[model samples]
Target: MIRRSRWVACAGPFLFPWGEAGSRRVYGLVASLAAAGYDVVVAGGGPEPLTTTALPGIDGPGSVSHIGLSEKPPPDAGPLASSIQTLLRWGQRTVRWLDAQPTRPSHVLVHGGQAQYMFHLQRWCRRNRVPLIVDVVDWFNGRHVRGGYLGPLHASMKLALHHYYPRCDGIIAISSYLENHYRRTDKPILRVPPTLDVKNLTVDARQTVDDSSPLRLVYAGNPHGNRKDLLGTVIEAVGHIQREGASVELRVYGPTLDDVRHLFDGRPLPDGVRCLGRLPQAQVAGALQEADFSVLVRRPERAADAGFSTKFCESLASGTPVIANLTSDMGRYLRPNLEGLVCRDHSLAEVTEAFRTAARLSGAQRSLMRQAARSQALESFDYRAYAEPLGSFFRNWD
Candidate 1:
């Protein structure tokens, strides 16, 4: 029998069963790798896990193991200091673990732009000759920095990232826009789409939504000021839709709902607008089942939005048509007329017209769109398809 000798270390923010963008992608990839028989270790966060409970039928000798922040740092440190210390500790632990292991990994996959982790992992891999693959799903310098104190931190991280990219064996970027954005690195950059967990899709047709209610338009995502402010235009557009007697309600779900809710500032909604705070990922599909469509209007303010939004795939998975304003790199992957509508500008008229067009589609037509959405998702966005290339890369890394 082949001894399970290959050990792969995958690290990211802690993600449970239900996860956000980074968490979802990292967890899905790690699970797949574990099932394929490579001993895998996942190290990340400990604070606000969406699902702290373990997932049934997923345990194994080499299944998901969360590395907690508390294991390294004093539990009471401020968030920023705590994160830095966590990185230092995580780096130290990972190096020690790698050094003491009986068999070294063929490859190491590092996610995100944690500078300390990247530098330490690369240095150790170089010394030990383990190929390191870095996935740049989002960029730090050009995109992630938002307004406020976080901006400077992000700027510093970007500098570190620029300095670290050349040291990796390979890089996996999620979008072509990002691939081209970092062309100066002169390293092999693989453009991969964000993976969709279609298994979570509970509804296949848009008709599952209650038609009696005003056209249910929903936006499920972070409500932070940088990306969340786009909801303002959504409200303005929904107001226009309501003026046309198209009963419309906006449902905002995700961690940043408070940011979005505060944007309202007691300004009366036209009528049906409601804000449902962060809902579990398991609950999103059922909610999407009850809604007519999903909305994401990213203001061109940060690079985070310039990349891709997880809600984009989630919207497609729910078989709900998406109405988006900013045309980021995602525009390259979306199918026209079959999946949903993409607006050139965030004009009230544009949103109103898009809704009218959606209202005109027959049930069968909507079902066709839903199927197309799923097909596109499975072919382009699912993680399963990516395993071969990624696995082959590691398998051949001698």
Candidate 2:
């Protein structure tokens, strides 16, 4: 009998049952690691805490377990206070949980970029002679700076990044831009971009494209203030296409109908445009499958450029071609006219033209594009393959 290597993952206070992009990424990595014969324990959940649920669809291979924290942060607490409380609580619970284990984890994977818990975890790892790895999933500093809500908290987190991250044993970056930003001369760094479980997410048989049906385009994600530019661009482009008398419809999920109306400056949605509101992950997958194309347009800001959208992979996994702007590492992954269309600019005219190009494709051509999308997903973005790099890194670490 072989003793499986044990690992612990700590993602402070943000765990979910499913549907969230970030949580899904973490779950995918952990599940893949378990599938590869590691004994894995994921410590997560706060605020709205999670109950002990079976790791989604994971069974009969390697061992995987979840330890959900029941302590919830106060709703009235400020951002810094809430984060600090959550971190402190998680650290305490983690230490107790570790003490109960027969042996300490070989490595500790910290998911978030900046956390007070990381400092505590680092000290713990140091005392135990265990490797501590930080996965920088997004540019948290850029987001805080752009968001303008937590000034002092952002300053402290920036300091923490410079101070604690360098001391970590390894770093996992989600994009090339992030890898460059967090590069440390003494630490081992791996660029593992966001990936999806293509095998599970993809449709078994490609659906036949009906030429007579309207050219359906779908966009799903929060339409928050920072994301206004992309959502606005897509809305205007859809309006432009409608004015041209094109048989097209842009269905948007994630944002409420009232929010979508507000985004269009209180005016009515353009012809053939509908706000479908938020949908479950399964429903979003269904929407992607039913659509001819999916849209993701982001401005070339530092925050946007440093992070790759998980939706890009999810869209392709659903066998729907993407119409995305050249932001982040999207251009590096998506080949124009192969997996999807990449817009050179984020202007309405450019996105509108891209839509027109996709709309113009014949049924056979569209089917080919869908096949290309799924092929690209399986080739590059499969979660199992995505986990191999990190697995090797973990195993090779002395």
Candidate 3:
């Protein structure tokens, strides 16, 4: 049997663009392990093995080592091509790449979606007797979660995942909802919410902005599926605000804006509507600073219900107030009268009224609400709290 060591983590295809929360969380997890005196080796998919961390060529002040997987199939390749390539070439390349590493991990951390490729890695770790820890962020049946492509084969893949989960040393669920669902399997699982690096982030004073203006609203997230409904609500609400002769402006950031514009099909955004496209993470805080409130208007669905999006936490940390629709997990965390306003219905009038009320609040009043949002971020969603529990979860495998 292989002896235990103090290393953990397996880098997934989701490594680059470290600006995103999930990517950053993965890096943070490895970095935290390194800080705890564990030797960390992150094997991931990229153009090449990363010589530095995800700050685009620059490494952070962390002890973790990163290796990006270069030989994997390009992301844009269609299904059959990618599958053939992964099965024929990428798996061997990944194994060979891990073999070339100077050290192996005592505990392996594997994220979902990539579970199909993991059997090979699992078998390899079994031969080495390394303990495996799998983290599941979404329901295996929920293909729409995180924009996972769900073709006909998705069902079979999910079945494979169900079988795979029981063999792991431990499992991580990011929400109580997910934990409850997975409990049916009788596996050892932990529900740790998506956490933010709250120390590096601070609740900045709501910058001296034109509060007299109609509420400036910002929405950020992928623009697909039911996300379209949320965007439509924002647009209609902004129209109502304008009809009321208020100076409301709505700014959107994400890949879905272009598709939305196509849906508009040449109808111009009256005046205050702007599609900012997807901005870099560094610029998002500034964008948030400029806005009166952030928006997360997800529709009621299994996927949205089970997972809490990172956008919710980041907006709070940036000191931007949020205006979320009453659906999914919003009711659980955000009180309707406190923290921020929750539109309990899909009516455009209700959403517009909330925007108007946000506009009417005094600077101090809004600041208090923003503070409440930030406090929630620090106390519950901060990464530091999850680190010890998660680290111990891995360590117990010894």
Candidate 1 vs candidate 3, lDDT winner: 3
The weakest ten consecutive residues by lDDT in model 3 span 53-62
Q: Least accurate stretch of 10 residues (summed lDDT) in model 1?
A: 48-57
Candidate 2: where is the Cα deviation over 4 Å? Answer: 1-5, 47-61, 71-90, 141-150, 202-204, 226-229
Which candidate number has the best lDDT? Answer: 2
lDDT of 3: 0.65
Query: Tens digits of per-residue lDDT for model 2 on 1-398?
Result: 11344655544445555567767777767766666556666676553333343554443365655666543365777978766665455466655655566667877887753556666677788888888888777665345454354665475456556777767888878888878877744688888877656777748485577777788899988857435347877888888877887889888888888888877888878888888878988788788987888998877887777777888888888898899887788877689888889888888889999988887888887888899989888877776775556667778663
The C-alpha RMSD of each candidate to the native structure, in angstroms, is 4.2, 3.2, 4.0
- lDDT per residue for candidate 1 within 176-267, as digits (tens), equals 66677666677666766666446444564433333354566787776565344377777777777677777667777763545655666647
- Across residues 17-93, which tens digit of lDDT does each residue of candidate 3 receive? 35755666565456455544555666666675455343221123324556767645686889798777655453455
Question: Which lDDT value does model 3 have at 161?
Answer: 58
Instruction: Report how far residue 303 has shifted in candidate 2, in Å.
Output: 0.9
How do the predictions measure up, each by TM-score?
0.83, 0.89, 0.85
Candidate with more favorable, higher TM-score: 1 or 3: 3
Two-way TM-score contest, 2 vs 3, winner: 2
Clash counts for the predictions, in order: 2, 0, 2
State how far residue 367 of model 3 sits from its true place (Å). Answer: 1.5
Give the CA lDDT, 0 to 100, for residue 86 in model 3: 50
User: In order, what lDDT does every prediction score?
Assistant: 0.63, 0.73, 0.65
Q: Candidate 1's error at 391, in angstroms? A: 1.6
